[model samples]
Target: MQRRLITSVLLGHYLSAFTALGIPLYLPRILSDLAPGTPGWAIGVLFVLPTLCTALAAPIWGRWADRNGCRLSLLRAHAGLFVGFLLAGFSPNLTVFVLALIIQGTFGGAMAASNAYLSTQFKGGDLSRALNWTQYSARLAMISGPILLGLLTAQGLGLDLYRYLAWLPLLAFVLILPLPKDAPKHGLASKKAEALGELPQDMPRLLAVQFLFSFAMVVTFPYFMPFGEQLGIGNDALIGVLYSLPHLVYLLALPWVQKHQGNLLLHGLALLAISNALQFWSVHAEPLFILRLLSGAGMLLSFVGLHRCLSQRSQKGSAGRLFGWFDSSGKWAGTAAGVAAALISQSFGIASPFLVACLAAMAAMVLARPLLMTSREIPA
Candidate 1:
């Protein structure tokens, strides 16, 4: 049963990952077709809306899952995404498209839901390992999603690609159907426990670490392309490879990292800060490639460490609620990161975001110290 559940949720997460990450690549084109002369700010909104909506709505959905069942919440998320995609694919006007994105964000948190669902099945080191697999699916999807969509677009699917992509969530919905029902483990009593301040004290602090890590890392993403261009790496293909390098590192090193989990969070943050700092001076492709590899390695260490921390705390509280807020913290930070990147790049240069990221990573290391130190003695 554990194997089946993990496999199903991972597969479903893969499909969702592909759609969630892949579809955005074409949003600019879609907006151009539906609303010619779309303002730059509106295009910015197009990029940020789904994530912003997801950040806002995740906690509510998570609380609902604690009362209801994870399976139902997962199914509902897929269903909501299906509807959102259908509306997006068939949107006749900008208003409708915006609404579609709103729907998608509000109802589509499959990855977080998957984490919560898996948390119910595993705990301690096993839960960390399980979460590692979920990240694998996500990394694979992130790496392949755009390339596959580019292939489809090259095949002349063009704007209609949006319509075809809508079916992915439906397929994911089917993949989830065979899993045994995951009834609510926490129920309403856990809610009262939390409201009465009876849950674990470390949860909110862990979430702060999540937020800082996410912000520090993602703040560098929006301006990465320009940063690469400035480094004399102008090939689009090469840029894509650079973008994928970190996720590739995760695929290769995550298992080893998972097994050797020690004080990885602090080490990872230090590595991340160093990598980002080094990138500021990388004036050629050779050095930039090495820096990216280091960045990927740092990301892996930190993510696995954080997952382990969250898993440890989930053993003491409601997994669904904890992972829900966990996902929300990252999403909210990610949204802020994008805006901050834009402002920093505009005010300073394309590379300024890296400096900010380095500072943030160091800050995160400080916030993470208490958690990691205490977590060492916790079982699993």
Candidate 2:
């Protein structure tokens, strides 16, 4: 890969991933502030909306990147995200917050633009390493963002949480500023989609995998803390610690995923299924933390593998559309999962969410056939 391409792609991916992470990090505090007496179900929905939006946005942006180019549309997206997420912070009501999420969704897609361009422009394992590091950067944000938000919010910086959140997009924008200029064409898949044009045909299954994979994970999301609280796991501080449990292990798993980067699909899918099964053992509070961490470890593997899968496919060109579509599908699945969790929690209790995840993982193995190797080697 060209030095300029690597630099630009990672710069963009690194910034945007953290930029997106800030919302989830601050969500509990934001919702608690909004609904002092709000039911757990409502808080769960608020926490999930952003992911749903990102899921929806990724494909659109990916397509835009395909037709246009990476540089220009990404800039526009960051600008809008700045406005949108800032608006989310200011939301006086949950409805307003959800609106902001929808708006935020408009600009928030997967990182297909950066990855697609770099893969096309680069050769060898350098691109793979770059992708891994970029993935780690995002995981690193998952590691750091919540801790910083918790500390800062405790310090009273959160009184202006929404306004403060605007800084995220701004910060990411500044980081992306140093990026090399993208090709003169428009960016993201759909932003510049031409008539009769389409992304990879495998896109459907890839996106389906992304959805079910996220379903296996996100099914647990809305209930992570609340279930803990129900089982008396910890107060908010302890809850945050437990909430971050998966991310903690994901850090350790990062190098492992990179080390075995080849032939990741079956292992990733198998691990995902196992994680879902493990969650079944976590119904009570005591085992929840360990179960959650195991789940994260599984996710890191599957996601990196999925990233490898998507990257390899789109290496021909215009990966943004493909990743975007995959991203959006995953988000919708998470959304549907969230909605299901909300409804189920409204009736059965917190364990229902995880039950849903476990089932989803089993179903995912059905479609993972497309991702499976004829043998052990990951095709490139």
Candidate 3:
């Protein structure tokens, strides 16, 4: 039963991630088709608005999930995602597309929902393994979704691609139907605890680090294709490969890192700094590909490490709210990064965002040093 639950959740993560990432890979193209004269900054707005909405909405959904059951929460979020994808696919203009993203953001809590659900099922090494698998599934989707979608769209599927792919999560929703339901464990009690001023001590610092990590990671997403174009690579399929190769490396390296999960927070920060710095020098495809692979390694380490940290530190009965706030912080930071990236890219050159990311990563590494020195081991 536990294995089945894990499988279901992992599949959900993969499908949901695939759907979420597909549109972004083609966002620049999609915008050009819908609104021909939109500037890069406006492109940034489209990305930022949804994340801002998601940032605002995650905690609410998390609190609801803590009150309700995780399965019910998953169902609600998947339904919202389905509707949002349909709305985006069928929309007549960019305005509706933007609305679709808003809806998507408002209801999207698949990752947090999955994490909260799994947190109930496992602990210690088992918990770490489950969370690592979740991250692996997401990274797999990141690696494959773009490449496959890019290939199909390149073959003349065009905008129809969105319509076709929208059905995937719906299929995943069907898989979710058979999972055994669990009762809400600490709904009202957790709220009462919060009212009485009981909160995790390390939460604020963890959230700050999460925000910085997200900001550094996401700031370059909207500009990758444009940057590639500047380097003379225009084939969407090839571009997808360039973008995904890093995730591939990350996926490959995850297992080894999981087994030796020592001071990953520090390792992640260092790698992120190096990866972003390398991006500033990557004017060609080969160098950029290598740098992206390095960046993926950094991202996987950071994400897995932080998630494990959160799981360890979560107060009893408050996992949902904790994960929700964690997700919220990342979303908000990502929203800011999107806006900053657009402005930076517009004001400077396309390569400037990478430098910004590099600087942020360095700062995070420095900020994390004290925390790392104080606590070096994952709590058992």
Candidate 4:
């Protein structure tokens, strides 16, 4: 039963990566190509908004899933992703295109649902490893999704890339059809809609650490293309290659780290800090690629570490709610980073955001102490 649940979650993760990284692979290149008059910065600015939506929307869907079940919300969110991508493919204008992406982010909040589900199904020792498997699928898709999209773009079949991109998600929808529904549960975990209070006692510290983690990450993502252009690496296909580098590292090193480093939380944080600092000097193209490898390793550590913490500490049957807050923290952090990047880029030059990221990451190290202690308390 546990194995089956994990498999289902992994499949859903794959579908998400197809849309997430695949689009970014081409977006910068497309933005470069499509500036009829609006300048090329539109694509980058809007990129952060969709992710922000996920932050805002995740809790909404998560609480519902806690009340309903992860299985059903997964289906609904997947459907939204399908339509959002499909409509984006046929976007008549940038307005509709950006709007589609926002919608996609809103509906694609299945991640929180998936987290909630796994937290319930697995326990102690099996918990992190099982979640890591889902992360593995996500990592594979992320690594390959960009490369595949790049190949298509390089073949000169470029006129309708967004439309063509829709096929991948559509295929995912079909592939996901066979998974058994989560056995039904009556409504539970739904709090009063008006019941908002001080976040959980641990939330402040956790959110602070997560904010730095996200800031470090988003700095790499939104600036990749602009940074590449600055370094004179203009070929669009190379974007995919660049994006693939880190994910490869993520896949190769994560399991090894897991097996050897019993304290996944601390190890994950240290790796992440190393990668984040690496980005500050990763401006040169070749070094950036290497940094990407480090970045992937860092992300693998951080992602697995944080999730392991939540899965371990969650009260009996309260994993869903905890995971909901977990994802919400990520989304909100991403949003704050996006807004800061927009302001920073508008004022302090292109590389300024990365520098700010460095500053933020330095702070994360200080905040990690409480989180590490919290992880130790989580059940095995």
| Highest-lDDT candidate | 1
Candidate lDDT scores, in order, read 0.84, 0.65, 0.77, 0.67
Clashes of each: 0, 30, 0, 7
Candidate 2 residue spans exceeding 4 A from truth: 1-15, 24-53, 86-100, 123-125, 182-198, 229-239, 282-290, 374-380
Ranking by lDDT: 1, 3, 4, 2
**Model 3 Cα lDDT, one tens digit per residue, 1-380:** 88888998899878987888666757777778778999987876675666778789988887777667777777777777887888888889888888888988898767777777777677765676687788788778777787778778687665556667778778778877788775665544665665542346777887888889889988887798888888878797787677777678777887777787565877887788898888777777767777777888888878767766765665445667777888899888888887898799999999889899988888877776665665536642
Which structure among the candidates has the greatest TM-score?
1
Model 3 misplaced stretches (Cα beyond 4 Å): 27-43, 92-97, 155-162, 185-198, 225-240, 281-290, 373-380
Clashes of 1: 0
Per-residue lDDT for 1-380 in model 2, tens only?
36665665565565566656755656666677775677866666666666766766676777667666656556666676777778877778777877887776677542544555555455445555555666666677766766666677888665266666677666756755666655533433353344324555666777777778777777777677787777767678787777777776767767756667475655656766776676555646677667667677667777667766655565434555665666578678867877777788789877677777777776777787766553234433
Native-to-model Cα distance after best TM-score fit, residue 99 in candidate 1, in Å: 0.9
- Model 3: C-alpha RMSD to truth? 3.3
- Write down the worst ten-residue block by lDDT for model 2: 187-196
Q: What is the TM-score of each candidate against the true structure?
A: 0.94, 0.80, 0.85, 0.79
lDDT of 3: 0.77
Model 4, span 1-380: residue lDDT tens: 55665775677667766767566646766555443455556755676767778887877776666556666666766677777877776776777778788988888765666666666666775777776776677778766776677788898644277666666556655545665654333454234422331235686687677767777777656666676777678886686567567667777887676564345555555665666566655656777777667667767777777666555565433445566667778778777777787788779866677677667666776787776765554434
Write down the TM-score for model 2: 0.80
Q: How does model 1 score by TM-score?
A: 0.94
Total clashes, candidate 4? 7
> Residue pairs in steric clash, candidate 1?
none
